[model samples]
Target: MPLLHKIAGVVVVCAVVLGLTLPAHRRGAEKESPAGRVGNSSSAAPAAKVSGSPAPSGSPTASATPLKPIPAAAPGAAAVKANELGQIPVLMYHRIVPKPEMSLDRSTKELYDELTRLAKGGYVPITAAEFVSGWINVPAGKHPVVLTFDDSTPGHFALDAAGRPKADTAVAIIQRVAAENPGFRPVATFYLNKELFGMADAQAAAGLRWLVQNGFELGNHTVTHPDLSGMSEDGVHKEIGGMEDRIVQLAGRHTTTFAYPFGAVPRKGKWARKDGSRYSFQGIFLAGWRPSVSPFADEFDRWNIDRVRSEGKIKENDCTKYCSTAWLEYLDKNPDERYTSDGDPNTVTFPKTAEDRLAKEYRRRARTY
Candidate 1:
């Protein structure tokens, strides 16, 4: 057999093995629970955030073997902002390993550069919960950016004994950059499936707790990361609800955001939920080529929230179609269209033309920046 074919076969097998052996997380509430919260561990060493080991990579582009047709975008040659014309660029990532392993995977250096660029550009990370609530509340004069790491790969994050993000890991890189830049924030959302970062029960539980306790956010990415369009409502419920249950167990909190698996949804509609599940997400994510509009924007669609895949090197990833890197370039070339911070957290600001269309009732302190 050809060597390339053998390599592809190996990749497939590794994916399957990882999927089947991943420890379980979501079950009904009464099933069982871990021994204790993260702080209950025997170590008395105070949890002072420190640094950890070296590892990190980029988003998982492995599933979309072909550039599957993405959701229909807003009509126009120029990128249009959703509701009241407010746009927020959300960067999507997958496996953030120490070195790049695939087209979708990027190294720690790459992740660091991308994040630092945002920080330097006056961007601040915001939680999906905040986005859904229409309360951005990022520092005044800082544009809001959402960093989403899908798949929950082990390479994405790992901590040292001191509870710090170790070297080269995505979390560490993010924290390092945030610490170095006064206005940047160390916040992100992780969308997980059956495998929580390649860790077993206790380790997985700690990883989840570290995220919530440390000001990060978590979301449901379904149980096994299946194509939702093919499944019945019951199956979808099991997939989403089950994952939500597990995340609550591991993270000690419930998530109100979700990322569609394979970017597939049941009807290409606006929202979905498995009844009786502990979660009812207000923001549902779609695999992307651009950012989302403000939740309060007139065009905001809870059904198809958009996200841009991380990595600015568009040519290498067929970036024009594969991700949102082009928009970064576009923003560079067209600075005015970009979302610039107005130095106020109580109000939502955008181009003057959008003022008339603003949802007035939602604004307590409405004014131009």
Candidate 2:
């Protein structure tokens, strides 16, 4: 109990605190593909205006805030046989109308039923950004599903007078289904174009802000939904960057994902995922017919993720083979081929026989049991 002993204790405590405050550098962070950068002849578009009547009072500007990190898996046997190297169904929808008009459209009832089925089947929704970022966090024994709505149609989202989502819209349906079924995360990514859900200038802003404020995601679908396959690289950049700037202006946040208009990529496909002055897309999606490969799988392609149409066995659109209903049934019968999580995000778990199927970059965190 000497004065010198007290001074030594204080110094040791200070040193420990300083060490804990220092940043820990991470090793082997994923590197962007060395794809050729596309030229951006277009300047950043003017900031969008979100002010108007019926705006949510004191809405916070959408800034880049990190999502709540999921805690590590608790100690116990994993509820499901983990297969981090399996396929994931990224369901795609266009219009959700009271009555289906186009082959790609689904009625409100159909949408509800499909979502109910997914919930009952042990699937949890995640944003397209999260899926492409390999941040699939769901409870153990649950499969991650990405529900993407393209074209930003009026049937997707709307705000009622009381700032509630319209009852029959996709947003409301999702929220209702989630309420009825516990553990069903009511989140999805809506890719937007110039139409902005066919709303007036100011009302559109309120809707966009609402989506971001809630758990939904805003993604780039171009200023105009044109088939990029016919456009030059500069045109592609303009389309992508223009939408990115508009999203930042309206939502006050940048979009991490981009869905190709009509799923048509430019002649130079690499430009779809390249970083420009106004935009940097982490993942680019395609209007594919089947489910996407797990983001951690060796065959996964971040720039060209696939999505199954939200339809049943129908010959009208040739979706009989690879639509949502068919794919979900297939997964049900062949559960081992689906991506079942191990609850822990830090470690990748799969069957020992599937070890070679995992991407080499993830081997350091791999666990085969």
User: What 10-residue stretch in candidate 2 is worst by lDDT?
Assistant: 38-47
Which tens-of-lDDT digit does each residue in 64-120 have in candidate 1?
233222233223212323122457888889888777778788778888888878888
The TM-score between candidate 1 and the true structure equals: 0.72
TM-score of each: 0.72, 0.79
**Candidate that scores best on TM-score:** 2
How much lDDT does each candidate structure score? 0.69, 0.82
lDDT of 2 by residue, 34-79 (tens): 3431211112111122122332445553322332222333343144
* lDDT of predicted model 2: 0.82
